[model samples]
Target: MRVLVTGATGHVGRHVVAQLAEAGHDVLAMTRNPATAAFPASVEVVRGDLLAPASVPVEGVERMYLFPEPRTATEVVARAKSAGVTRIVTLSSGAVTGGFDTDFQLPVEQAVEASGLEYTHVRPGDFASNTERLWARMIRADRVVRYAQPDAPSLAIHDGDIAAVAVAALTEDGHTGRWYDLTGPELLTRREQVAAIGDALGEPVRFEEVSPVRAREILERQGGWGAENAGFLLGFDDYSATGPSFDDVDWSATLVPSPTVEEVLGRPARTYAQWALDNVAAFR
Candidate 1:
C-alpha cells in the first residue's frame, strides 16, 4: 500500500515512516518543510501541511498516519475521503481522562471515522521523550532539575513504542477499530526518571522540589508563559504530582498503563531508561 505519513519530521511520525518502509510499504512522509526532512532513502519525502492537507497530492495514497490537529480536521478528512484513502491511524493523547486535549482529540477521531475510512487510534500517555522538554535545559546547564512533582508517577511510553503500535495498526489487520493505550513496561516517578537519565549520562542529576505555585512562577519568568497559560499548565503539573489519582470525577480517564504495546507488537515495551540512554547526547 502507498502510505502518507503526516508530521513525518516529528518524533513519533519519524518512527512510523521508518517502520512502514521496513515493512515494504511505499511510504510518503509529509512535512511542512520537506527540505529539512531526512528519512531513509526508501521513503518518499513531500511537502505538506496538516492544516492544508488537501494541498498535498494524494494520488495513489491508500493509508495515512494522522497526527491530531482538530482545527483543520474536517477539511483534511474531506480531502482524504475524496482521494479514496482507505485507512487513517492517528497519534492521539492518552490524556483523554479529561482536558482540553480530550476535547481536541475526540472530534479529530470522529472526523476520520466519519470520513468513511478504517480508523485506529493510538493513544500514548506522557511520552518518555517529554522529559527532554522538562529537563533538557536544566540538565544541560547544571545537571539539576527542579519541578513540582518529584514522586508523581507516569506511564510514560517511548515515542518509538507509540509509533510501533501505529505501524502495526496501519500495515496489519485486526487493528481496525482498536484503541491502543500505549505505555511503557513499568511506571516511574519524576525523580526516578531523572535518575535514570543521570545513569545514562554517567553523571548525577539532582531533582529539586518546587511548589506548584513557585514552579508556575518560575515557568512564567523563565519560559515566558503568560499568566493564564502558566496556571493552566500548572493544573496538569498539580495533577501529575498526585500520581495516578482518578479522584477527579471529571478527569477520570488520566492515562494508566496497559499491555497494549506488547500485545500488539509481540514484545515488551521500551523502557524509559533505554530511551534516556539512546538520546543521552541531548542531555549532555
Candidate 2:
C-alpha cells in the first residue's frame, strides 16, 4: 500500500513510519520541514504540513496515518478524501471517551467519524512516554515535586505498541470500523511510575507534592510547558484520583495472539527500567 503519514517527525509518527517501511510498504513521510525530518533514506520525505493539506502530494496514496491536532484536522481529512485515500488510522486520545472534554481531541474524532472512509480510531491510554516530559525537570534536578497523587492508577501504553496497532489497521481489513483502546498489561500510579524509574536507574528518586497553584508556576518556568497543557495535565492528575470507568471491555482479550512490542521493533519493547537506563543521560 502507498501510505502517507502526517506528523512523521513526532514521537508516535516516527515509529509508525519506520514500522510501515519495515513491513515493506511504500511510505511517504509528511512533515512541515523536509530538511529536518529524520526518516530513513528509503522513505519519500515530503514537505507537507497538516496545517496546510494543499502542500501534500497524495496522487498514489491509498491509506493514511493521521495524528490529531486542534488545527486543520477537518481540512486534512477532506483533502485526503479528494485524493483517493481509502483508509485512515487516526491517533486518538483515551481522554475523549473517558469524559475529558479536551476540545482538540474530540473534534478530530468527530471529523474522522464523519469522513465516510474506512477508518480505525487508535485511542491509546496515557503513554508511558509522557513521563519523559513530565519528569524531565525533576530528573535533571534529581528530585521531583509533584501533586502528591500516588494512588492514581494509569495503564500507560508504549509508543511502539501504538504504532503496531496502527500498522495492523492501515494494512489489514478486519480493523476498519473498530476503535481500539490500546493499553499496557499492568496499571501503575504516578508514584509507582516514579519508583519504577528509580528502580531502573538503581538510584533513589524523591517526590514532593506541592499545591496545584505552585505546580503550575513550576511548569510555566519550563520552556514548551504551555499554560493550556499544564492546566490539562493538572486536571488529568485530579481526574486520575477518581479513576476512569473505562467501560467493561477487556482490551487484552480483543488483542488476542497480541502484537508484541518485539514484533514492531524487531526486538523487545523497552520496559520502564530499560527506557530509564537508556535515557539516563537525559536525566543526568
Candidate 3:
C-alpha cells in the first residue's frame, strides 16, 4: 500500500511516517521543506503544504494521514479522491467531540466525510509535547513552572501514540468510519506534570502558582502556541461563548483518560511520566 502523509515532519506526522515505513508500506512523506525533513531511508520525501493543496502529489496513493488545514481542506480532499486515494486518517482534535470547536478542525473533517473516501478521525486530547512549549524553557532556566491552575488536570496524550493509532487506521482494516477520541493512560494535575518532568531529570522542579491573568500575560509575551492559545487554555475565553467568562466547561468530565488508544492498538497508552522521560533532553 502506498500511503501519503501530509505534515509529515510534525511531532505526530513524523512518527506516522516512520511507523508506516517500519510496517513495510510504501510511504510518501509530504512536507513544505523536504530538505530538512528526515524519515527512514525507505520513505520517499516530497514537497507539499496543505495550505496550497496543489503542491500535494497524491498519484497512486491509496491512503493518507491528513493534517488539518481548513483553508484548503475541500480542495485537498477532492484532489486525493480524484487521484484514487481510498482512505484518509485525520489528525483532528478532541474539542470537536466536546462541541467547543467549529471553525478549525471541524471543517476539515466535514470535507473528508463528504469525499466518499473511507475516513477515520483521530481526535486526541491535550498533547504531552505541549509541555515543551509551555514549560521547557522555564525549567531549563530555573527548574520551576509558574502557572495558573496548578491542580487542574489533563490526560495529555503522547504524539507517538496518536501516530500509532493513525498508522493502524491507514494500514489495517476494521478502522474505517471510526472517530477515535484518544487520551493518555493517566490523568495528572499541572503540578504533578511538573513533578514528572523533574523526576525525569533527577531533580526537584518547583511549581509556583500564579493568577491566570498573570500567566496569560506571560504566555502572550513569550509568543508562539503559548501566546496564541493562552486565553483558551487558561479559560479566559471560550470558543462556544466567543468571549470572556470563566466556567464554560467541566474539567472533571474532560480530564479523564480514555481507553481508546489501548483498545485500538492492544497496548497501554503512554503515561505522562513516560512522556516526560522520553523527552527529558528538552527540559535539560
Candidate 4:
C-alpha cells in the first residue's frame, strides 16, 4: 500500500514513516519544507502543509497519517478521498475523552470522525518527551527542576509507542473507528520523573516546588505555548493541587494504563523510566 504521512518532521510522525517504510510499503512524507526535511532515503519526501491543503498532492496516495489540523480537515479529507485514498489515521490527544486538553483536540477528532472516512484516532496522554521541554533546561544549567504539583501523578507515554500504534492502525485492519488511549506502563509524579531522569544520568537531581503561576510563565517562554495555552497547561497542576482537572473529575478511575496500545501492537507500552534512560544524553 502507498501511504502519505503529514507532519513528517514531528517526533511521532517520523517514527510512523520509519515503521511503514520498514514494513515495505511505499511511503510519502509530506512536509512544508521538503528541502530541509530529512526523511529516510527509501521514502519519498513531498512538499505540503496541513494548514494549506490546496498545495498538498494526494495523487496515488492510498492512506494518510494525518496530523491533527482541524481547521483544514475537510479540505484535506476531501482531497484525499478524491485522490482515491481509503484509510486515515489521525494523531489525536487523550483530551477528547479525558478532557485534559479537549479544547483544541476535541474539534480535530470530531472533524476526522465526521469525515465519512475510515479513521482511527491515536490518543495519547502526557508525552514522556515533555520531560525534555519541562526539565531539560534546569537539568542542563543545574541539577534543579522546578514545577508545580510534584506529587501529582500522570500516565505519560512515549512518542515512539504512539507511533507504533499509529502504524498498526494505518497498515492493518480491525483498527478503523477505534480510539487507542495510549499511555506509559506506569504513572509517575513530576518529582518521580525527575528522579528517574537523574537515575538514568547517574546523578542526583533536586526538585523545587514552584507555583502554577510561575510554571505557566515558564511554559510560555520555554515551551513556546501561548499565554492562555500556557495557563491551560499549568491549569493541570492547579487542578491537581485541588482535585482532578476536568469537569468529569475522576483521577483514580483514569490512573490505570490503557491496554489498547499493547493489545494492538502486540508489545507492552514503554515505561517513563525506560524513555528517560533512552534519551539520557539530552540532559547533558
Lowest-sum lDDT 10-residue window in model 4: 236-245
Off by over 4 Å in 2: 143-147, 236-271, 274-281
Query: What would the TM-scores of all predictions be?
Result: 0.89, 0.81, 0.95, 0.90
Residue 255 CA displacement from its true place in model 2, Å:
18
Expressed as tens digits, the lDDT of each residue in 18-76 for candidate 3 is: 99999899999999999988788999999988888889989999999999998999999
Query: In TM-score terms, which candidate is top?
Result: 3
**What is the C-alpha RMSD, rounded to one decimal, of candidate 4?**
3.3
The model with the greater lDDT, 1 or 2, is 1
lDDT at 43 for candidate 2? 97
Candidate 2 local lDDT, residue 132: 74
- Model 1 spans > 4 angstroms off: 97-101, 220-233, 236-247, 250-256
**C-alpha positional error of residue 103 in candidate 3 after TM-score superposition, expressed in Å:** 1.0
lDDT (10s digit) by residue, model 4, range 1-284: 89999999787888898888988999999988887677668999988888888877789988999898867887888888888988889898876666555445566677767778898999888888877867788799899987788998989998889999999999899999998888888888889999999999999999999998887777667654234356656664432233345655666878988898789988898888888888899898
lDDT of 2 by residue, 1-284 (tens): 79999889876898899999998999999888888787777899988867776887677899999988757888888888998999988998765656553566667777877999999888776777777777767766755536546666766677777888888889976788877766665667778778877766677777777876776777777747434467666653433324443343344433322234444335544455555565566566
Candidate 2 local lDDT, residue 9: 86
Per-residue alpha-carbon lDDT of candidate 1 for residues 1-284, written as tens digits (9 for 90 to 100):
99989889888999999889888999999899988887789899988887776676577889888988888988887888788889999888665424435456777887888887899998887788777765787789999987787988877888898999999898999989877767788879899999999999999999999998987776666563234356654564333332344444453234456888989989999999999998899999
**After superposing candidate 4, which stretches have Cα over 4 Å from the reference?**
99-103, 223-228, 236-248
Candidate 3 Cα misplacement greater than 4 A, ranges: 240-246
The candidate maximizing lDDT is: 3
